[model samples]
Target chain A: MKNTILIMGHKSPDTDSICAAIAYAELKKTLGFDAKPVRLGKLNRETKYILGYFKIEEPELVTKIIEPQSEDMKQDIILVDHNEKTQTIDEADNANIIEVIDHHRIVFNTANPLYYRAEPVGSTSTIVAKIYKENGITPTKEMAGLMLSAILSDTVIFKSPTCTEEDINIAKELEKIAEVSIETYGKDMIIAGASIEGEDLADVVKTDIKLFEFGTKRLLVSQVTTAGVNKLLETKNQIIEVLEKIMKEENVDGVVLMLTDIVLEGSELLSVGKYASLIGVGFNAKVGADSVFLPGVLSRKKQIIPKLTEILI
Target chain B: MKNTILIMGHKSPDTDSICAAIAYAELKKTLGFDAKPVRLGKLNRETKYILGYFKIEEPELVTKIIEPQSEDMKQDIILVDHNEKTQTIDEADNANIIEVIDHHRIVFNTANPLYYRAEPVGSTSTIVAKIYKENGITPTKEMAGLMLSAILSDTVIFKSPTCTEEDINIAKELEKIAEVSIETYGKDMIIAGASIEGEDLADVVKTDIKLFEFGTKRLLVSQVTTAGVNKLLETKNQIIEVLEKIMKEENVDGVVLMLTDIVLEGSELLSVGKYASLIGVGFNAKVGADSVFLPGVLSRKKQIIPKLTEILI
Candidate 1:
């Protein structure tokens, strides 16, 4: 008998990772596989709201999937999340993983026996969208909503440079399936997620942060979204100061802070040290004494990465 | 004098295109422009069904919008149907179409001055989705339902290759707003649109037939969807025979008949010509006497064109 497999993604389980696991499980069922949708962490308010809109119960949180990606057939586990707790294949108790898929830069290591796929794309939801498209599986609105939500969350409402035409197309398909106006949902979700009243300045800068290595110099990119750009503008200096300390602590070459105005279709870019001029020149932005201002840079992923990479490297 | 602008695509006024036009018009109003959404052709039963489901009336048919995108102006107009009858654009218009935006590959050169945009992505609705995204606009559930309906109709429930990530994302968003399941709604809509019993075989195929030109070859790709592929499968040869005649009469390089089985997640690719093998080879597909079984193939735009172009060129 095949054992039950709990499919999941990173902690804070954004829409794409959550929905991909669910849709894939549904597809696995169609293809005669035993799988279940699992989340590694608690759902955020926006995710909860979208799920409630679709009347879908929140998927159970599975701390870890036993056998993750590869073929040791050994009961090794791969840990994921900011806190990074350990989990192993023996704990998942599944005979085989069948498949492990994600869009993040592949941080986990696992020992498993089965199929797995990973690619560097805008969102994991795009990968799942392709799977459903290639399988001829018509997604339910709940799944579509989840996928759309994931894309919005990951792409930061297409602000992230991670978004592609494929991501946009998948978002479009999911929009019809989920039956929500993405722009409306995206704006609302961004607004809901952007409550920065009492959060730590460091926490705000670290919220959905990613690190990149360019040559000998390391780069830290942090993205924060608000309903409007005013909040970030208000806390601009504090954020820059916090990032400076974190950079020193992390021993990073350069650090950048991006405050996305979800409703305003642009972002304010703050940079420290040697990277400021590079980013400023590449983005054709307004250069200040300590930072650069991007007039139309709402999405950190889409707007910053390409230009920064061009200049940094 | 205020000018009248009519917005439409093909015959059916779907959710994205329809709602986008409405939302854009609303945005235009905020920006000091007058616009209205207009349907060029009559809506099928599915459009009517979804509209009834959402308790909204169908938009008036504009027959054609005389305005063009180049002028960057808005207008009021009269409505007309396929029968060439007319009404005041205000009295007959379904939604306000200030600018014409589409994603279908078919380029237009109309009698009216048209402000048109067509992107080679999945659905015209996706373009509308972007308008709302660009303007920070929010749509009501009823409006979201209209956009989702358009997307479902145009994308063939996300099976249409024309579907993009944006389309899927929007579909998901719309699903929540419309309070309907994407899969269930898709099944119902496909069934509603799947009436081959009374349709003239040739006429059915002729209606909404898409033409593609590659090198010296012009391929005629006709799509007809049915709930069950089996019944259509029974009439396949007959449909093929009619398609062959149509292809010959139209003087095209080749003919491909796509009998889309929406629920089944596959397409029966029937081609009649020396070029049939060209498509088979391009897609790495299995070929019969005059056909190929395209597994996991859905959209006519996404799947067929890329494959066909590679082989023919």
Candidate 2:
């Protein structure tokens, strides 16, 4: 139908990105709106595990929101988790973004007014769960499970600096509804997501990346969480090669990858491309040839992006 | 204190703009925040009448949100009713927009995530009233009166095309708390605002204007609601001269004034400058030198701006 609205997150879907889209789409459907959840990219390991555990179908993948053949048709969308043009699906500039439910820095604008709800929280799922509670609609067990997983994943099991009291409260409520133990389930999910043993180095470097614009420079920042940072560093040269290719292809001034060890609560930062050394200058850490270990740096949004933005802008 | 947050509306503030800012600031204060309401420009007659009738003090007027001497000090702001940088106070770009509660097209962006709530409602007062209800805080009689008056003024007593069912419901609840009959009070406020008798033509033309950019062309759209459109038309040449001066001074491609008649429920469109004839082409009406009467056209946001944007872009 022409009125059918697509709900999606950003390209390179993570747990919160995919789960928030599905949960919000379900909320919209209960409110008598024709909505479908879609994903911009393949699901990551943790998101795949959660969806499989919950017996929820993976959202259909879509590269372009508006097709040329459907240019005259109304392609209404509701963005969740992310709002930047650089991070969304292709041809999003041509689609009608009717609503945005996000918890990230806003680099978005629209010509007409619509429903926009943003909060400085750990995850978009926190806001979505809050909305469901506000509307007096309890989520189904499957939806609750997905949302709980997303909160845990995005907040790094409540260890992230971005986590808030609201996120913890909502996660507790969702844990009860989903009949899951937060400690055991969250640990399992995080461990599952952190395993990159069989994955290609290029895909590992490409996944969970975001493009940021600072003044005149474009930078691509990527993060991969693991249980052992040294295991990933064993392939440091290969990762740097992949980063350099991505920087050239994306036409960004710099590329950075954070090899985060969840248990260690730190990240081994790898930098490549034009403005790589500025990362060390921004963080006040000595720049190694390619990498430096920053202790207690878990959040890309809070611990990394803002610092880089300050130095770059 | 450095933590004081200023809440304000756009330049040439209207009833909804001023009242919504005041009500939201009060809500923030009740929630234990250091908040103060401010206005970007002198209040229009309708807003001044509502505040005076309710015995509420007018908000402080501020031209620039940040002082150059206090550049290192935190200047946090919350915008209400409007979000476009072109319509907000001077130097808003330098201020930290911590929150935005708006009911207009979004042309706003931020580097950091914050509380942003927008809805496609008739007035910002409608959203503000809903928030008060959600938070379990009852507005005082004075605040309720101001909010009710704003809904009536912005919705043209629920006659404008932009009026929504939520506006009417919220207005009724606010009217009861305000202890005022909606019909009589709304009529008095509207009539008071519509009277342009003894006012300078230039001042009337300059009030309630918004700058819109479409495909590199900037258009200044001004609106004035009156009971007697014919009386205002008597000074059409003088109004055109003022529009011409504003067009040149603002360096805009075009300037348009919509002389709306609240009782008649129509607007007489006047155009000046380079893109003048496009207004007639956009509305499919005959362009008579400077003016064209469009019956059943009362909303600049709903009817006029979208049509002009379609033609211009």
Candidate 3:
């Protein structure tokens, strides 16, 4: 009732998503607006490293939300993801998403009149950087450094397909303010987050889950991740098939799964699509002898969405 | 000689610049290559936020390299910016650049031999996300989230003038691997960075500097900072006159400076141009107004470059 705004992001909160949500909320507050940051899934090891870097505490993990999409979302409940990208929602001058921030390809079925922008950079934190710019705001050195670190972690030092030059520039600027070396710091951060000693696999997946809706054909895009590479590939198909059955029973459109080989720099995209070819062609997957093989596919957001949009559209 | 790579960023180092250097170096090392990230200019607060987010230290700041820009850059010199989009140096197979990454609008520059990609996102860290997606590539969750955070920071949570939808989506996806909350965490990062106490006003300007080249002329663009809006506006004209003299004394074609009031969400763009009218049109500044009154202009890379380019071209 206090003009509450839900700051949400994608599932599986990363540094970009987490930092964007937090920065955006702060910006709104500075602009005299009430906003709360929410996450769709749990935090990961790398995100923890970023949080630790800034000496900020991480948010709690959230498994379920009231709705799948933010569009036409019930005023009673707001759906927020870790990536902080809003998909759909009705626009209202007041209390209707005043802004939606993200760094992924745009995909929303909403009739909301709101301020929205999505860039081609590696992370949503890049978008947050602009928010500070928009408000004539400059982040504290520590804050800037943390956001810069988030960009480096997601963009892979700008080597991945998803990176852009702006990301690199912004990171550099923030680095100066933060007074730290990103290359050396990034290595230390990665080493810090490498431990997956004791955790529930399902819990990890649920922590960063996203609910997708295509014309009421609901689907759950659950990104399951493991620390090792070969282990994920070995049982990739089995995991997909099982997830597919689970989705079908739940009256969902399909289950699109990712078997990520983090070390090899590729992903095994498995889907139970009623129209597999359509989805496959959309994703630019190899017309495999059996299952679809996305060579050099590292990101579901960058690789799969483009193809999926083509198919879905 | 030992395959050393010098990583360079745009004139002003932002979150993407800082993170790309670190993440890319890590990826190269994983691929069994020698790489080092370098900052073209001094870093800023946002970059510090990102580094802190990932718990990674910052890279050494390099104001300039004695080496010149060339197609025959050695492996020791990696010229990386945060604005290369569409095509990248990776297209060339013969050049020793070996790899390139960025997050700004695409450029028309010729490609060099290297592995590269330019996304439409706002930060270079988005590219780092793909590196994590590689097979057998296992960056720490903190590293992954660090990249994601950097993207959001650079893109202003996908709200900047240069943001795209793809950037938002990729950031969302990276959240899973990074395990960060976009809203709260990002807010913390920025807040930490916004506190600029004990900062040298001159130091802020000297770092993260960009150069503008016009027809038969050149301009050095830099930003000076103040704690509040009062000091910034008070010293606007004095700063401009001083910069103009310095520009002439240095024998440079032009000098444009920004008196950024981080708290007020505005900037006073000051410049001394031979073609004052052209510069005015380029910056949308008024005649005799002294400095351009820009509401919410924080990023020289994102806010100023494109507009200036339009006027220059």
- Native interface contact recovery, all models: 0.00, 0.86, 0.00
User: By summed lDDT, which 10 consecutive residues of candidate 2 chain B come out lowest?
Assistant: B65-74
Q: Rank the candidates by TM-score, best first.
A: 2, 1, 3
lDDT digits (tens) for residues A168-217 of candidate 1: 88788788888889988777766777776666778767756788877777
Please give me the DockQ of candidate 1 compared with the native complex.
0.01
| Model 2 clashing residue pairs (backbone) | none
Residues A165-240 of candidate 2 have per-residue lDDT tens digits of 9999999999999999999999888888989878888788778787888899888899888878887788778888
Better of 1 and 2 by DockQ: 2
iRMSD of all candidate structures: 21.3, 0.9, 12.9
User: What local distance difference test score does each model get?
Assistant: 0.63, 0.88, 0.60
Give the per-residue lDDT of model 1 (tens digit) for B172-287. Answer: 98789778898887788668767766768887777557788988888899876767777776777797788779878989877887877877778877777668777766656654
- Candidate 1 structure lDDT: 0.63
The 10-residue segment with the lowest total lDDT in model 1 chain A: A76-85
Say which prediction, candidate 1 or candidate 3, comes out ahead on lDDT. Answer: 1
How far is each candidate from the true structure, as Cα RMSD in Å?
16.0, 4.4, 18.8
Instruction: Provide DockQ values for all models, in the order shown.
Output: 0.01, 0.69, 0.02
